[model samples]
Target: MSELTTLARPYAVAVYKRAKETGTADKWSDALAFVTLLMQDEQLAKAAANPKANREQFSEAFLGLCKDHLDTEAQNFVRLLIRNRRLDLVKYIAELFNQYKAEDEGYIEVDVSTAFPLKDAEQARLSSVLERVLEKKARLRVDVDPTLIGGVYIKAGDRVIDASIRGQVERLAKRLWT
Candidate 1:
């Protein structure tokens, strides 16, 4: 795992526990989504990175941007992050939080890359196969990559099964060279 992932795990777990206790998982999900978006904005990210911007300024700007979307609990969470200087972990935190949410909901996040979009039936088949392979229900995100040539690359959590033509060719070339 990356350092960011390591740093993010505890925060994600804490938020998940709070959401579970309060029966507000969806609300926290929305708030975290907003925080993730705010962190992605270039200007806001730069401002957050600026040492001259005090914690109060960062918290105010962040909460201001998210005012309509946030509840008191969410606002306090943002303030806590700012005070702890963990704003840079926002993205990673969201990622980990979503992972926990999915697990709690009995869903696995899968990434699939193929040369073209799969039909509805094809997608269903892929999801079925992945569910069977992973022993969990899957929610897949499909991406079309022409450079893949053919076949699909499936990633479920830390496991990657690359069945793409490019991957196969590269392996073949490596084997031949060796």
Candidate 2:
């Protein structure tokens, strides 16, 4: 994990706890996403990263942009982050928060690296197959990696399935050498 992610984890956990208690995990997820998007603004990002910038001013401007999209709890959450100088970690926090939400909702995020791009039908089939094998609803994020040589490599949480041609060759080479 990145240093920022480690720092953001506690905040994400706090938000997640509130979300669970209020049964509004989805709302919190959306709010975090929206706040993260807003943070991408060039001016806002500069101000957020500037230690000399006025926290009150920055918080008001940030909250103003968020008031329409975020609930009161989310606004308060933003203020707390600003007060603690953690605005820059919003993206990581949002990511971790969403992952927590997905797990709670019985979904597993999967990363599939393949030598070639998959067609819509191919992606659907692969997703279905992964869901069956993993026994959880899979959310696949696909990437084309020519180094894979052929086939696919699947990463879901701590589990890795190396079905790629390059991976097979490396395994065979390792066994032969041993």
Candidate 3:
């Protein structure tokens, strides 16, 4: 995972820069997301890995399938990936590109895990609190983890706020053992 991100970062940065210069960051975001999903398809993965699959044919088929979503610049980007056999990096590239986009837009992506699903009001309240504390808008990726027992665990960038029941119990146990 780290290797892929390291390898894909330069390309992702290049794409993001181009999109920013062309004033098409949002469009490129959509195109990259579509391409990433297309590349993840089982059949496409098999074809991409097959030594016998004609590279030209595979490239044409992929472009044709995504014709509606891609513009000229996006088509060229896809071609570059295909030519370099870097299609596998599409997912990482999209992720990195999204990170760049979020930073440019002055927001941070956060992952929140809870024992139960949060209500809309609960989510909004949490978002408001996080934004106030973090001093940036928060884009949350929420998940339910029954093993958490109760409360919430939030991860934003390099910071973690673990208020889960399991986390509290672990801390108390560690202190007692020490």
Candidate 4:
């Protein structure tokens, strides 16, 4: 995972910089997503790995698969990826591009794992508190996990707040075992 991220970072950064400069982050987001999906096709992967595949032919086929979804800029981006033989990195590029777009839009996406579903009022209060604490617009994605036992597990970027009952019990067990 880390290796893929490291390899994809430069491409993601370059594309993001171009999109940021041209005010087309949203467009690039859609383009990258589309291309990423296309690259996931088994036939496409086989063609990409074929040493005999002509670059022009591969690029045209890729662009054709996309139909009218991509614009000229996006078409050129696809061609560049083909020329560089980096279609395998498209997924990571799209992920990083979305991350960049969220940061630009002042959005912080967080995941919340709770033992039970949250009520409307509870969700609202949690969002409000998270927004205040994170100092960015909080977008919460909640999941019910019975194994959590109680409380919540909140993850935002590299930070994780594991206040779940299972987490506490595990910590206590570890201390006692040590």
- State the lDDT of candidate 4 residue by residue for 43-134, as single tens digits: 98889877789999988888898868898988887888789887888899898887888898999888999999999899999999999999
lDDT of 2 by residue, 58-100 (tens): 8998888887998888999899999999988999999899889
Please report, as a residue range, the 10-residue window in candidate 4 with the lowest summed lDDT.
73-82
- Give TM per candidate: 0.91, 0.77, 0.84, 0.76
Which of 3 and 4 is the better model by TM-score?
3
Give a tens-digit lDDT track for model 3, residues 1-178: 9999999999999999999999999999999999999887999988876777788888899899999999999999998888888888999999899889989999999999999999999999999999999999999999999999999999987789999999999999999999
TM-score of 4: 0.76
Candidate RMSDs in Å, in order, are 1.6, 3.6, 2.6, 3.0
- The whole-model lDDT of each prediction reads 0.90, 0.92, 0.93, 0.89
Those runs of model 2 whose alpha carbons end farther than 4 Å from true positions after fitting are 112-117, 142-155, 158-178
Candidate 2: RMSD over Cα atoms? 3.6
Tens digit of per-residue lDDT, candidate 1, span 143-171: 99999999999888889999999999999
Output the number of the lDDT-best candidate: 3
For every model shown, the clashing-pair count is 0, 0, 0, 0
